[model samples]
Target: MIDARRGVLYPDRMPRFHRLPPMPEAQHLVAWFWIPEWDLGPGETSRQDVVAYPALNLVVEPSGVQLVGATTAATHRDLTGRGWAVGALLRPAAVPALAEKPSELRDSWAGLSAPDLLEPVAAAMDGDDDDRLLRAVAIMSRWLAERAGEPTDAGLQANAMSELLMTDAGIRTSEQAATRLAVSLRTLQRMTHRYVGLPPLAMIRRRRLQEAAQRLRDDPGIDLAALAAELGYADHAHLTGDFRTVLGMAPSGYRQEL
Candidate 1:
């Protein structure tokens, strides 16, 4: 299972962010929907840190619609004012359908405009919150349904390979990922690098670090040394180093924030 709990970085602010499962037919194309609404006091600015998965997103915000691509590393978005957003998180296999070279979109986003599915979604944006979200996602679903063709055999297998690496903690390291995918290590690396926007090890590390951050939020009192070892970190210092490097905060400090 893709652990939803481990996807977002700031669990303490859960009320401001949430995700909904995509319709079954859209699962192969869209992983889920992320909804974030925030009201900030004057002089208040909040930064949202995210350890994104090997996927893309269609984000609709107060500004406009944007097709957010896969990110090669961790990133943060600074939030201000009172605003809300609805986003469709695309799956790894869905990248090629949207962009020929997935890496071209890595860490970058493209703007969207009128005359697409955004019309209805944009029109419904001013209404009640629930209705707005429903109308928006429904239109998006219809749009994706038209292009939800099954990916190539290798793409499908690559998605399956990513799934195992992300969801199963037992499968650590690229070698383990190759074993799970029943492919040679070199083959898995090549496919993931070409289609997934990152090497298998990098993607695996991203998911692992996200999971670690979540655990820190959920149980701040847990032993960092044990947690580090459990998560395959070389040592306690290793865990802190990764936390600081990726999230810009030490693990202990992250837990304290929670």
Candidate 2:
């Protein structure tokens, strides 16, 4: 579980026992909810189930998304930039609807500049008496809905896939993903490429490497070989190779920097 203060915006809680679905082979639009808070609980003890948003997330502080989990909860504090934020959730078929159209729906989704959406969101967040947050999300939802025909689109699908890959360590190839999706490998590849940018294998490797880096930073004494095995690497050397590829530094060096 996670915790939040009276006033702080944070990411949403990760869904447990739930997984994201596969991306469609067509274009789509996506929207995200951001919450902010004032004061949060002490660190090291607070935890929350956080579902990672698949696309680029615009995190605004002073006010942000309220992350709800099954057990723990906390308000997230702004560690970087100002309370105002604008970001993008770029994906292939999952482009923002504004860039494409009903005809292009089969090929790409629309892309939104966070700044465009942030103004309304910020106004809502700034008010003491306004349905600002709700209205802002509603506006975003309407915009996305008009573009993609669905509130959640290919971006969300890719996010769910990423979470699954991260949780399962890795899935080896698109064939595995296809099996899960009940689609052909080509179809799955196209969908993944459109919605996730990178292929499935690359995504899996990236997540594993990211996990390894975090482990090294938090606990240098973690057994490299075991860590490699846990992340589904062939061996420590293989894991080390990937670590170098993604981070441009060996795990040991990464730890040193930490």
Clash count in backbone of candidate 2 = 45
User: Each candidate: what lDDT?
Assistant: 0.76, 0.45
Alpha-carbon RMSD, each predicted model? 2.2, 10.4
Write one digit per residue (lDDT tens) for candidate 2, span 1-258. Answer: 011111111113211111111123221333234443333345422233222222333233334422111111112323322233322232333343333222232222333345555566577657766455555455555444454555365556654564555455436565776677666878766655555444566655655665676667457799889988887788989987875665556777756655
1-258 per-residue lDDT for model 1 (tens digits):
687666667755544776777766677767788888788888988888778887778787767788787776578777777888888887766667666766767789888663576666667766865666767677776677666575668667867876787888887789988987788999988877676667788778887788888887778799999999999988999888888777788888888777
Deviation in Å, model 2, residue 53 alpha carbon: 8.3
User: Which residue pairs in candidate 1 have backbone atoms (N, alpha carbon, C) closer than 3 angstroms, thus clashing?
Assistant: none
Task: Indicate the TM-score of model 1.
Answer: 0.89
Count of steric clashes across candidates, in order: 0, 45
TM-score of each: 0.89, 0.55
For candidate 2, report its TM-score.
0.55
Model 1: lDDT equals 0.76
